[model samples]
Target: MTSHQPPLWRRAVAELLGTGLLVSIVVGSGIAAQQLSPNDVGLQLLQNSTATVLGLTVLILMLGPVSGAHLNPVISLVDWALGRRSGTGLTLPDLGTYVVAQTVGAIGGSVLANAMFEVGTSISVKDRATTGHLLGEVVATAGLVLLIFALAATKRGVLAAPAVGAYIGAAYWFTSSTSFANPAVTVGRIFSDTFAGIAPVSVPAFVVAQLLGAAVGLGLLLILFPSAARNTGDIVLPHSAEKTSA
Candidate 1:
């Protein structure tokens, strides 16, 4: 593939489309699990979460070559913090464009779920979203973002993409929120009226928690992988930050 400086329009569109696709697969799977095994919620969550990880991993692998497929605002922020973000740090234009694309994409994905499952907001908020649950969301999302940056954004992780997928799969099990790591995914879940709906009032807490968790995860990653964490990619894309500047 060629190194790209995408037309602004195309990149923005890609961000939206990618987010939409992620939600459709994720929320769609959650609905499927519920309907297929209504009585066994534990099993349902496990199956749905597994499908989600695979879906996201596959989506990233497929779309990443085209767009870098950051897929989450927190992931982008962590990359910027780590010095791997394009333009060397997060620029307002880049951040704004990405956030808008992700938000729009989330809505698009939710709409698709609405159509496919015949789901409507008519189903009231069963998941009022407690503070503890939101706490779980923060921890789960942060770990996911940190993993993405450490493994994919950093130079060492560029070569360990498959491991990134493995770690995510496990995170879904270990984390209390079943690892709804992507902010785009979190945003899209609001559209679902099933077990995943997060009340609008509680969204601020979730977002704050996600941001904080990502920070902690990054700190842990730096401590654990000191040498690799030091990598600062002179490269923008298609090359690890660790690549020699020859």
Candidate 2:
């Protein structure tokens, strides 16, 4: 089945809405998990991860045809880096637009979640700036990017939604920082002083770690799929879809 790619304006709106809803799911579910399982931290995590997995899967499947469902800046940058020369990937202007939309949408999502939960919008006080947490972020993001591109390179793009969701669900449990793999989501989490929130001071280190992880993931992609042809556009677009770079 051929997929119709929307115009840049519509695509950007999809990214904005997709990213906003994704963060709302993350922060909203986290808050619910906390409230539902006040005593058991493990149960809270389980609940949060489950909701995130399901939510992310739905979001990707729903928006992949539109904007490539690039809810993360790193994904957009990587797509641009690998495909810019091919003239099939994202252009410089597209990158800037996607990043801005994702970031602003993320912050809006956080506020929306806070309002929903009757939690006043406030900066997170929970500091997650330890070295171990930073390392965990690096690992989490690297694995995420690797999983995404690997699927694309191997012609397993059809599985991108479920695989990406499953990896993130697992990463939440295994990673020390609970794997805020997306930079936009990380920024959004700062607006909620609830279960999913991260302190403002911790944001910079986490973003740096994620960027480093993206670099690492790109290197690994080169090594692992040396002869694999690069895919154009976003990390995961709907199968057989054609999209013009913004």
The numbered model that scores best in TM-score is: 2
lDDT of 1 by residue, 54-110 (tens): 777676665554445666777666656666533454445766787789888987887
User: Which candidate number maximizes lDDT?
Assistant: 2
Every candidate's lDDT: 0.65, 0.87
Q: Write the per-residue lDDT of candidate 2 for residues 56-172, one digit (tens) a residue.
A: 999999998778888999988888887855666677888889898999999999999999999899999999989999999999999988888888788777788999899999999
Clash pairs (backbone) in predicted model 1: 151-157, 233-241
Which residue pairs collide in model 2, if any?
none
- Per-candidate TM-scores read 0.81, 0.93
Candidate 2 — worst ten consecutive residues by lDDT sum?
Answer: 237-246
Off by over 4 Å in 2: 1-4, 227-229, 239-246
